[model samples]
Target chain A: MSSTHIVSIYDEELKYLSRRISEMGGTAEQMVADSVRALVSADAALAQKVISEDVILDNAERQINEKAIVTIAKRQPMAADLREIMGTIRIAAELERVGDLGKNTAKRVIAVQSSGMPRKLARGLEHLAELALMQLKEVLDVFATRSVDKAKAIRERDDEIDAIYTSLFRELLTYMMEDPRNITPCTHLLFCAKNIERIGDHATNIAETIYYMATGSQPEGERPKDDTSTSVVTADVSEASE
Target chain B: MSSTHIVSIYDEELKYLSRRISEMGGTAEQMVADSVRALVSADAALAQKVISEDVILDNAERQINEKAIVTIAKRQPMAADLREIMGTIRIAAELERVGDLGKNTAKRVIAVQSSGMPRKLARGLEHLAELALMQLKEVLDVFATRSVDKAKAIRERDDEIDAIYTSLFRELLTYMMEDPRNITPCTHLLFCAKNIERIGDHATNIAETIYYMATGSQPEGERPKDDTSTSVVTADVSEASE
Candidate 1:
């Protein structure tokens, strides 16, 4: 094949990898939304569906790894090309974890349903999930477009999710304190809130990856974690702020 | 340079990555051991050290990413060679998380010590950390050697950690139930136990990566997570298992 043919083929491989991540990201975002919807409504079937469909995200991650590894072997892409492949692997893994987080939340839906629903918490969770899913969708687009500015902008929104998480945590703790029966279900919901917060972190990671792909450097410094209330333990008591 | 020289150079790069990982693993392992010691002894200074020293692990992970990315771009290795580099990135990330887990556990030492130490829980945490640290060390060796047999053997022990974790969960919950004052400290310790459990998961990920590097394929199915106790939410009522 001519050099142009070889270049075009390599380009196609890269394109295919990006498209897979976008699809995976879309699925992951949907999972986040659906998992919360399941939680809020106590919809067992939708919850189960999210749990079952995680394997699709798993398979997408596997394919991305295979393709990226093979592409590096075949094309020996340099500089930006290499970062793009690495970013793809990183983003796919993030999306896959996002799926797992959503699935875990879905599982919580079942647990809460079995115990009995705490209706007030559901509204808070839905609000938090909406913020997280929006971050996920925007970060994924940043990945696809290599938009560092957009990525940085998305990074700022992690705190919003964190702030919601903090408030919900305190509210859940009060509920548990008020009613012993609330303990088990609230414990489950506490973890679910953490799962959603983690999903937000994964989105932030994707944003950082976008920054890395565009600039050949990761975002400097730790992304601020503003949801301080649920910090189970840390050296700084300040991190336990409400 | 002759092809021989180039191959030798690539070999050196792989060796360097292996050595860096080993060093990082040792630091992570020590962090685990030290954190548990801090917990058991109520040594705030040691706990403080682990918390502050996490920046080292962070730096190690950054270096691993830089080295792996550059090597892939320059060496453009195929098959097992490519898998090795990818595995390094994955392992380094896992190790970094291990460090974070240890650091978090150390933080719990401070939290619990401030409240008052529950002596019995100390022994249990020590035992779990020992198991997890052992797994971390052995798995890092498996990664270096690409020993499929060793990796598979390590995967089995994750169940042991999970079992310990499960039992520990019950013990802590009992503690929380017994005294209202115990709730905050035990809650702190529960999250610490979870951090250790998660460290074990990272070891399992290394085992999985080792399997993939050896055979160019991931393990055929899900690694058994015998940690039925920490199933915060699940479909089965039985999952609130003994």
Candidate 2:
């Protein structure tokens, strides 16, 4: 075969590999969502399913990596192509981590069940999980479409999750404070919140990865202005009120 | 320059870059240790010093990146050399994060001082910081030497840190339970313990990265073992005790 034909074959293979990776990302995101849902709802069956499905995600990751290696070995792809392969490898690794997070959430759900926690706390957890899932879906959309604007919007959603996490932390703190009996259950719920928050972070990481792939630049999030005038006044007022 | 001479120059430059990265790692590890010491001992001067020295670690990271890019563009490194450069980039990033952890600990110390928490709680937090610092030191040693055995040993140390974290959690829980007035200070200490625990996790991450760089194989840390028998026994014993 001519060198050009070989190059064409490798290009085709690269396209296939890229699509496979994106599909794997989709599956992993779903797994994470489902795992969180299981934890929030105490769906033992769903938790088990998520744990078992992890093998499929693992397989997808392995296949993507193998294809990348084979393409590199056979085609000796240069700069831009090499970057794409590397990005695919990194995204695959990140997606695999997402799958692990899902499995961890599922395991925590099992632990919480075994610990005999009250089920009423699941309502807030379910809300947090849904928000995290929305963020993951948006991030995957950004990845699939290479939508820079969408990626930025998804990045903004991280603040929403952060706010939720803060509220959840305070709520759980109050729960534990109300009674020592609430400690173990609240702790488990706190871990569930943490796992969901981490899912949001992973989605943010995907957004950053998308931004890098599209522009070869890291997007710096705008830092909150350090204008301390309001904070100062508030501190003084609180002191005066005290 | 002849191609051979250019290659020689590139090799030397790569070696120098790696050496500098290793040196930065050493500095970061030391900074973490001293920052924890300052926090535990309530050494205001040492805390201030750590906050200042963070700039040096930041500069080292910048230098490492600049050198890596120069070598990559000029030397045209092949696959293995490229992986080495990439590893250095990642290692530098991790080291920068370690530096940030130190700065964070120092900031927390200052915050605690400002809030006028009891000096006794600082002692417990100091022990937590020491545990974290020890784990980080071992992780860096493992990274510098690329000792798989050492990496495994560092993983064990992480368990000790986790144990300390659990006890610290219980201690903080007791404080918060004692009086609602104690909530703010105890919560601050809890955050301090959490920061230390997270620092230990970062160390473990670096250890995992080192294992990858040294062996070019993923470590098996995430697999769920079937310890059903132990779990059952423990469950029964706990039930009986309860």
| Best-fitting candidate, scored by TM-score | 1
Cα lDDT tens digits, model 1, B46-133, are 9999988898998999999999998887777888899888988998888888998888788767658866666678889888988888
- What is the lDDT, from 0 to 100, of the residue A53 in candidate 1? 92
lDDT of 1 by residue, A36-78 (tens): 8888888989999998999999999998999888888889889
Candidate 1: where are CA atoms >4 Å away? A230-242, B230-242
lDDT of 2 by residue, B1-242 (tens): 79899778888887787688778777777787787677666678998888788878867876876576556545556556665665676677677778876776666565445445556666767777777777777776676677887876676566667676766666665555554444444554555566677777777767766766666555776632311111111222223223
- Interface RMSD (Å), every candidate: 6.3, 9.0
User: What lDDT is reached at residue A37 by model 2?
Assistant: 77
List where candidate 2 sits over 4 angstroms from the true fold: A48-78, A114-121, A220-242, B23-31, B34-79, B96-124, B147-149, B155-157, B183-188, B219-242
Model 1 pairs in collision: none
Error of 2 at A116 (Å): 8.0
Tell me how large the interface RMSD of candidate 1 is: 6.3
